[model samples]
Target: MTSDAPHSLPDTLFDTAVVAGVGLIGGSLALGLRQRGLVRRLIGYDASYDVLREAEALGVVDEIKTKPGEWLREAELVVLAAPVRVLPALARELAPFLNPAALVTDVGSVKSGIAAELEALGVRNFVPGHPMAGSERGGVTHARAALLENAVWVLTPTDHTPLTALSRVRTLVEELGAAPVVMPPDAHDSLVATVSHLPYLASLALTHLVARDERLSLLAAGGFRDLTRVASGDPRMSRDMVVANRAALREALLRFRRQLERLEADLEDPEELLAAAQEGKRTRDSLPVVKRSLLPQKHDLVVAMPDRPNQIGRVTQALGAAGVNIKDIEVLAIREEGGALRLGLESVEAVARAAELLTQEGFEVRSRR
Candidate 1:
């Protein structure tokens, strides 16, 4: 991923930065940059005037431009946050207005095609990027600076990319509290296909499989809800993402099919089925708890709270007040009058501290490491 080209530009603050398509990702990036004082002035452009206005009203940007023009000339950094399908056209449209020294990047999930296209279009400073963070919720209204905290941000620079441009982008990403990773565009797309794209498709398929079953609603519980949560994301956005990376996604689907076939064949053998289940459990448990930690050993606690208003809020607030940073959280075994909340903490000491705090608040807690 390293380029041999020399980077002559001195490190400096960006006086003017531009963000196109200020939706969730764009709005979040704008908020993160502005909150950190990384840019002197932030300008936003979007196809929807309503979005742009809302973004400005929310203090996500300093100015909102409905279309590209001379204002782009002042921008030292430009982030393209549009959907996967429209990124190429958006880059092409904004190319002429951009100054020669400006650095360009994007939040588009599919990068291989866009990277090649931007390079061919003579966008020399373009460094293709995709942030591994977001929610099922969409739109600028859902945008928050904390959404990107500790997230993995992948940067795929073309052969023509200058080392200076990559360094500047990487610095900005770090300032925004995200971990920056460099890789080839094709490799990035291929890796995300199995982990990101394939999971969304699986969620969609599972939801569709049970959509028409009238009896499933009452039977559906936390597990079902968790498994299909991605299906509830913006449909048009999901469609664009999957379609844009169809080739890699197709290969991922084939690999997944083979796994399912093997699982089916092992169903008749109890030992084989148990072994498969154990392997899955081990693998899932071994995944790093903290996104920034390569080899994390997470400590978990299950807190049971009575069904009451503000119970969940109280628990989290108590931990937050104590500076107990929770690595992850999930609701489990929800009942009509009560429920269990599983919290993942970074260290055993933190887990002990959290458990003690919650217990002092009269909540039942169990710790597992």
Candidate 2:
């Protein structure tokens, strides 16, 4: 067994973490924990030993354990990154081996069922979490280090969840550069049903309809490709998500059916349908390409700076120390070696002051707007 204390993670909250199921989420979390210095040691366990070996070789895990019980005994944190269907059984399997104080969390999209199952198994420290981020592709090979960066990670902790355990899980998420949003289990399921499950179902339906049309398949262009792109997601995963959130998904489908019926009714009158389509196009076009918070707000000054370390903090500190409140800020580009940073502020006065201060601090800052 490896010691928990490592020089890389001096302020680490969790000494050791075991990621169950070395798929995309598991592999990505292992990589993030190591890169961000969040944990001293990270180990992985998956049913596929070959994938586990591959993950270890790829540096996603420090070690691979075929026996989860052996690793769970030593882990301070255990993250269940398995499929939604396998989660309840996996929880039951690990329940006996888990330490009394160990923090258990899962990356499953559905929460209510898993929460109830864990509770029934006498797992009190479990905190259900779902990082609202993923790619259409699956597997550990597709796991990227920045998979969770700037993404909203939701934690649905039931009344039985320990406060300390939830806090530790939140810290782990933030360490991976994700923003943590707390919500009730049912609320999370309902919201995901509309925003995520419905979209997946729509994409699948759209893809099936297009595939059935011999002419449409041959002539499908960018628009069709873009709209049906998410249909390429792992079929098994999509099926599980739909089944898990069936109630909320049924509600969303009903609402979608009503909208489709309205459109069909309008199509009976060609002129009215055309006018409605035109109006829809106009409304979509009128919407701002980028949000105001993402872009510069009205009457705000936007400054562009080089992508140097401490450049943003320096500018913000200077403005903040001088009692200047930043209305908005956007990091436009960092793809190049000396890429520029964009800062947006409420007033021209703040911009002028910030620019002067940044220049005095020996940095290149320019006013973009």
Candidate 3:
């Protein structure tokens, strides 16, 4: 079932895709890929035979196999949608059986470790991806086709990675209605440690703090439930994330502690506490309103811009003057010389017009939608 050439992919990408670990992420990916006609046959493998059978029954996978390695022979793309801790071993097992040119990827939360391990295994086509999408709910039974829609899918590709392979994986991700963001392995880990892993840890701690009070549990309402919701996620997955990104997580934890200490210090004085609370509300209220765009009628138009003073204001002014109102503007990155800006608009035409106007103003702009 191996592909003959080392550079070619199957004609129809959705014709066959093999997913290891038919749990929530894997099952959802399979279903989404199928619904979008990205693949015709979706084969799945999981440690739990019962879950595998259920995936098959629910049409999450066209076929379910007990041995994941067996399916790799025929799969054009192999997605390792397992826990962070199990990624290394899974890569090892799949490395020996994978089609030489098959684009291999994963949905692991952390990337550096797995990327290094797979690179060492001679898997040059490996693309370590992490979809910044998930719910507190766990297991294959909760899988939904729309889980990845409008979500961010980050790809960490090494220098040795083939461009074609990366593009293939990007297409697959996009077909499932997810955006593919490329970043360095270390950057991916560091970013997720702050945004995902650290938050999960904080949620766990918050839950523990409240769980100790019997009265609090009895009177628990929406705010407490909302804050501690992530604590209900799979304990094993949460533990693995903390361990995998320990260094970054430690830094995040320290910063969090410092913030907490500042809050505690303020609480010692009534006026100080009230002022601090007011400041929090003021800052929160000042956040840009995320309105639905009337012009760019689409997801978002991402553009790269020079990191100069007044660059953002200039771009907004240009669009605003042209009657192309921006729904939301986000600065995704700020490098030494340039930055990436993501503009949420209601129409693609508005984005094109904005790009033209920015270009005319002697600024570089590129569509990143």
* Best candidate (score: TM-score): 1
- For candidate 2, give the lDDT: 0.79
- TM-score for each predicted model, relative to the true structure: 0.76, 0.72, 0.73
Q: Which tens-of-lDDT digit does each residue in 1-369 have in candidate 2?
A: 112111123456678888998899888888888888778899898888999989988999998887756558788889999999999988887889998888899999998999899989988789999987788777889887788776778999888876556656776786787767778799899889987899989988888887878798877768888988778888888899899999989998999899789889988889988988999899878754422243324343334456567767877887788887776664433233443445666677777887777677666666753
Better-scoring candidate (TM-score), 1 or 3: 1
lDDT winner, 1 or 2: 1
Q: Any runs in candidate 1 off by more than 4 Å, and if so which?
A: 1-12, 290-369
1 or 3, which is superior by lDDT? 1
**Order of all candidates by lDDT, from best down to worst?**
1, 3, 2
lDDT for position 231 in model 1: 84
What is the Cα-based TM-score of model 1? 0.76
Clashes of each: 0, 0, 9
Model 1 lDDT-worst window of ten: 1-10
Return whichever of 1 and 2 wins on TM-score. Answer: 1
lDDT of 3 by residue, 248-348 (tens): 88888898889889889988788988988999899878643322232124546656677678888888888889898788776544343566677877677
lDDT of 1 by residue, 228-290 (tens): 888888899899999999999999999999999999999898899899999999999987654
